[model samples]
Target chain A: MPLFLRGVALPFNKGQAPDADVLAVSATGPVYIPLAKEEADAPTLCVEENSTVAAGQVLCHVDRLPVFSTIAGKFIGTTMVNHPLYGSLLCAVIKPTRSKRVETLPPVEEPDTDTIIEAAAQACIYDELDGIPLADKLRLWRMAENDQAALRSILVADATENDIYGSSAWCILKEQAQEALYGLQMAARALRFSRYHITTMLPRNRRRALKRLIGRENVFTTGDEYPVTVYDDSRDDVFCIGIQACAALSAALQQGQKHTHTILTVAGDGVPASRNVRVPFGMDLEEVLQACGADPEATVILGDAMTGVPCQNTHFPLLPGITTVLVMQSHAVRTPQPCIGCGRCATVCHAGLLPYEIVRRLENMHYERLRYLSTTSCDGCGACSYVCPAGRDVATQVLNANETRGTIFLNWGGVENE
Target chain B: MNNITAPHIRTEAASRHLTRDVLLTTLPLCIFSAVTYGVRPVLIVLFSILSAIVSECVCCLFRRQSMQVIRDGSAAVTGALIGLVMSPMVDYWVPMLGAAFAIIVVKAPFGGYGRNVFNPAAAGIAVLSYCFPQRMFTYPIASSMNPLPTGMSVGDEVVTSLSLAAQLRADATPSITRMQLILGDFAGPIGATATLLLVACAVYLICRGTISCWTVVPYFATCALVAWLFPAAGVSRMYGVLAQVCAGYVLFTGVFLINDTVTTPRFWFARLLYGVSAGVLVMLLQRIGRVECGCCFAILLLNSIAPIMDRWSWYVWRYVTRFLRIRQEVKAHE
Candidate 1:
C-alpha cells in the first residue's frame, strides 16, 4: 500500500489576526513588463517605446499567452529588471494614465470548449497556480477530449500553503466563494465534465463556512504540503487551477474583460502585518509594499519562499502568475558542512530516491550508479534540502544532474522515450 | 547570485551537532569507566582523539584538499569510539597508533567521512586486536584505584588475569554475580564494564533519533536468539544468552559502532539484515574462541560486504516481482 507522504511541518505563524483581515493595496507607480529572451522561443514584442496603450491590450506574444497591459498607460521606454518567471530581461516600462479605459472583449453566450479556449488565449488567462498558460492547458485538454480517461477531475486548489505564511488562494476561495464556484462551473460547462474538488488549508472554524458555500463532498482539507493539495490522486489526470484563476475565468465570462487584476498575499517576518490583497497586474511591487504598509528596510521576495525565485529588487511590476509578495529580514549565509550520510534527506524526500547518495555519486562522477538510483525521479521539491542536517543543497545538485544528463539517466524503465 | 545556496533554511541538527550528541552520550559511559577502571581509559580517549585529528589534517594536506574538512567532528567520534572499546590495561601506544591508522589508512584514503567502506573505530580495534593478541585480552579490575600505566603494572589489586570472555572460554562462569557483571563490578574493557550505563546511553541516542532501532534492536535480538537456540558447552540456554549479551563490549559495539550511518545500508530492512548478519558472525566467532570481542571484527567485515548485500537484495526483489507479474498475466490470459 502506498503511504501518505511525510514532510517537514514548517513553523508558520498561525495567528488569527492575519487570517481575519483583507487589506486593499493599490499600485500607482510605473509598471515594468518583462519580455522573454530565452534561446529559441523568446516572446515577440508588439508595442514599442513611447506608444500609448489601453488596459488589457496585447503587449507581446509568447506562445498562446499574449502579454496584456493591466493598466492603460503610455509606454515610457524599456528598463532592464529581473523578472520572477523569466530571468533578467528588458521590461516595457509604462507610466499608467490612471484612466478607466480598458480595451474589453465581448462576452460569449453559451460558449463551447473551442470558444473558451480561444477567449482564454486572447485574454491570456494562464493557470496562475503552476504558471502554465491556460491556452496551453486548454490545447492539451482539447486534443484529449475524445478519450474519456484523458481528463479525470478539475481540481480548484486552495490549499497551496503548507505553512500559515503563504498565498491567498484559500482566502479567495472563502471571500469570493461564488466567483470561484462560477469559474469552475464555467470550465465544467465549457469542457462538459462533472467531477470537481476544492482543496483548502484553512482552520477548522473557517472550513465549515467554505464547505457550506461549496458542498462538503466537493471540498477536501489538507496540511501545508504543496503538491499534495495540487495533484492529490494522479499527476497526469488531475488538472488544477487556483482560486484566482477560477475567479479570473468567471470574470472573463461575466465582466467581458481579459485577465487584469491579481489576488496576492503579502506576509512574512519584516512586514508590519500580513494581509491578502487584490491589486491590478503590472503594478509596481514597491508601490504594493508601500500600500500594504511594509517596512522599507525589509527585503522583498516574490512567490513562495521555499521554491520561489528571489527578486533582485522591488522595481519590477507584479505579473499574473506571481502569487505571494514575501517581505522578510535578510538571513545571514551559513557555510555548509559535509554530508555525514545521516539519510534524513532520503527519509523526507517525497520522491523515493536517495538525494544524499545521488549527490555523492555526482561528486565522484559515478554516472552509471546514479542511473540505477533513479536520480531522474527527483521532482526538485526541496524536501531533501529542508530535512538535510548537513545543510547541503540536495535539490539543487539533483536538479543540476537532471538538467545536464537530460534523458540518458532518466530512461530506466524503457518507457520515457515512447 | 546570493552568497548562500538554495534551501535557505536547514534542519537544526547538523552532522557536527549529531556527532557532538554521540560524543555527549558517551559521557556517562566515560564517567562510569573512570570510576571503575581509573583514568587510563580517559587518557586513551584523549590520545586517540588528538592523533585522529592530526592524522586527518596531514592526510588533507597530502591530498591538496582544503584543511577545513577537519571541522565536521567525525574524527572525534571515531577516536572516542576506538578509545571506548580499547583495553584499559593495554599499552598507551595501542589506541594512539590504532586511531591514526584508522584515519589515514581506512578513512582518509577512501576520501573521508561518508566514503569509507569500514567503520573507522571498529577497523582500528580489529587491527589492534590482531597486532597484540595477548595485551588486547588483558582486563583491568573494576575499582576506584587509579590504574598503573602499561609496562609498569605490578600490583595484584590493580589488574585481573582473565576477562569475561576468557572465563566463558574455560567453561567457568566468572565468580562475580550477574548483577555485578551488569553493574560494572566485573573485569572487562573500561567502558564495556557497565552494561546499565551503556544501555541508558543507547536509549538516549535512539530517543534523540541519532541512532536507529533498525540496527541496534535486531542486533541484540539476533544475538539473544542465536545464543538461546544454540547455547555454548556447559551452560543453560538462558545463562548462555545473558552471558553472551552482557559479557565483552557487545552491547556498546552494537549500539555505537555497528550502527554507523556510512557503514550501513540505506533501506531499513537492509540495515536490519546487516545487524542480524553481524550478530550471527560475532556469535559464531565467539563460539570458536577466535576473538575476544567478535563484534568489532564482524562489523568491519560486514561493512565491506554492505554494497554486495544491497545489490543481492535488490536483484532478488526485482526477480520475485517480475515472476509474480508474469504468473498473473498468464492467469489472466487463461
Candidate 2:
C-alpha cells in the first residue's frame, strides 16, 4: 500500500462559498487588509498592478486565508473586527504604501549589520545555556571559529537567542569560541542577503476577476466587498482564464497578465543565504537563486515542491501556479528506485482516497473510482508526495488523473450537471 | 543488535505501478488463450474486459465520484481473468457483471489497488458463482471439438470434452492423452488452454518480480499431494498427482488464481499456508462435496483468509525467534 491517500471529504456545504466565487490572495500581488474590526479569514488577492480596486471584492481562497484588501483606492480597505483569541491583533490595518517598482524600496542586502541583528532578535528567541551538557555544547560557546555549522548556531543565538542542538548545524563542527563568533557573523551575513521587499498581491479588478474565476454563484458576498466576475470570458470578468492548462500542476495561469504570484523556496547546502523570493512571471529562476547567494554547481532546480519541473536553465520563466524552484544541494536523494509498497503515498492525501487504491485503479483500469473520484478536487498540496520513502513522483499520478479525467468527462459529458 | 533500525532497502516493485509488469508477465497466457480458443474466445474475453470497464464506470457515475483510474488496466485484468475462465459464448453480461463486482465492491470499496485483501478475480468469480452460477460454470465451445448440447440442466453431468462425451456414452473412460491436456489442446475455458503457456507466464511473473513463485509451486504441490493421498477415502486411487496436475484447469488456477497478490500472503510462509490450506480445501471439497468446480471455492476461501494468514505467519515467526533466542541464552549459561 502507498503511504499517502488523495483524501476526499464532502464539501462543507453550509456557509461554504461556491467554487467559482472565491478569490485567493497572491503574496506577490495582493495586500490583505481587514473589514470593520473583526478577526477575518485571510484577505483576497484583489487589485491588479495599475487598476484601482473597489470595496466589495470578496477576498478568500476556499477555506484558507482572510478576506479583505486594505487599500481604499476604488474599493473599501479590508480590516479585522474583534476576536477573543487574537483580540488585539484584529484592529491592525496595514496600508499598502510600498511602490510596485523593484527600485523603489531599499535593497535587503544593503541593510546595516545592527539592523539585521535587531530584526533577527525580534523574530527569534535564544535558549539558556545553563542546562546544556558540557560534552554537547562545550564545542560551541568557547571559540571564535570559522566552522559554518557552529557559526550558524552562534549567529542564530545572537540574532534570535536560540540554541542549535541536533540539526544540520552539526555538519560544520570545529573549534569552540570561533564557532559562536562565526555563528553570529554568519547570521548577520544571512540577514544582509535579502534581495527585495516581499508583498501580497491583489488583482486590480478583484471582485470582477474573482467572480469570473469562481463563477458568480460560487462567490459568497457578505457585507464585505468581494472581488468577483460572472466567469463568461469577458474583459469585465475579473478572472483571467488560464491560456493553457498544465495537468502536472493543478492550478491554471491567469491569461493575458504580464506578472503573477508563484511560490518561492531556496534550498541547497551550498547556499548560505537561502530565502523565499516571490519573483514576477518570466523572471529567470537562476537569477533569483543567484541573488539569494546560491551555488549553481551543487544545485538542482525543482519547479514545484511536490513535482519538481526540472530545467537545466536557472532563468526559466516564473509561471503562475508553479510553486517554487527549490534548489537542493544534495541531488543524490532523488532516484527512480523501486517503491516498497509501504503506502506512505496514500496516507497524506487530503482527498480521503488512498493513493495506493488510486494507483491500483489506474493500473487495473477500474474506471469506476477513476471517473467518480473527483480528480478536479485535488489541490496538489503534495503532502502525499512528501512522505513517500521511496520518493516516487506522486504528482505524476495527479497528471495521470487529469489525463483519465479528459476521457471520462467526455464519455459521460451528457450524463448530468457536469 | 539486529541493526534493522531504518533504511531498509527493498526491490521497490510498485504494487499499483506494476500493471505493465504484470501485463508483461501475463502476456504469454494471453497468447496461449488466443491460440487455444482462437480469435472468437479472445474477442469474447476482450468484450468481457470492455464490459467490466463499462460496468465499473457506470457504478462510479452513480456514486457521483470519478472512477477515471479504472480504465488503466485493473478492469481489463479482471475482465481477462474472467474471460480466461468463461465459456466464450457464456453471455457477455455474466463476466462483465462479475468484473464490475470485483472492481467496485471487492477492489474499490476496500481502497481499490493495493488496499484490496482478496484477489479481484477470485472475488468476482465468487460473486458470479452466487449471481449466475450456471453462466459461470457452463463449459466453453471449441472448433476442434464437436458442438455443445443445445439445452441441459444446470447440474447435469454434461461432459466438457468430446472424448469424455464418447466415454460416458460408451460407459467407459476415453483415451485422452496427458500431453494433450498439459499442452492445452483439449477444449476448456478461454484461459484454461495452454497450461504450459500459463506456466511460462507464471515463470515470467516470478522472474520479473511481479509474482511470488513460492506460493504457486507449493499450492500445486499440496494439491497434488492431497489428490494422490486421498482419492475419495477408499475409492480406487486411479489418477495420480501428475494426472491431476494436468487434468481440467488445475494448472491454470495454480499459476493464475493461487498467486493473486491481494488474495495470497505477502510473506513467503503465509503464502505457503494459503496454498496448503487451499489444496486441502480443494481436495476435501472435491471428494466430500462431489463438486467438479472445486478450484473456485479453494481459491476464494484462501483469498478471504490471506491477510489473516499473513498475520498468523508474522505472529508465529516472532514467537519462534524469541523462543530460539531464549534457548540459546540458557545453553550459554549452562
Strongest candidate by lDDT:
1
Question: Highest DockQ: which candidate?
Answer: 1
Candidate 2: tens digits of C-alpha lDDT, residues B92-125 = 6677777877777777676555456677787777
| Candidate 1: CAPRI quality band | acceptable
Model 1 residue B217 CA deviation (Å) reads 3.1
Error of 1 at A299 (Å): 5.8
In order, candidate lDDTs are 0.73, 0.46
Residue-level error in angstroms, candidate 2, position A245: 55
Candidates' chain B TM-scores in the order shown: 0.89, 0.79
Clashing residue pairs in all predictions, respectively, total: 1, 126
TM value for model 1: 0.83
Q: Interface RMSD values for the candidates, listed in order?
A: 1.9, 12.5
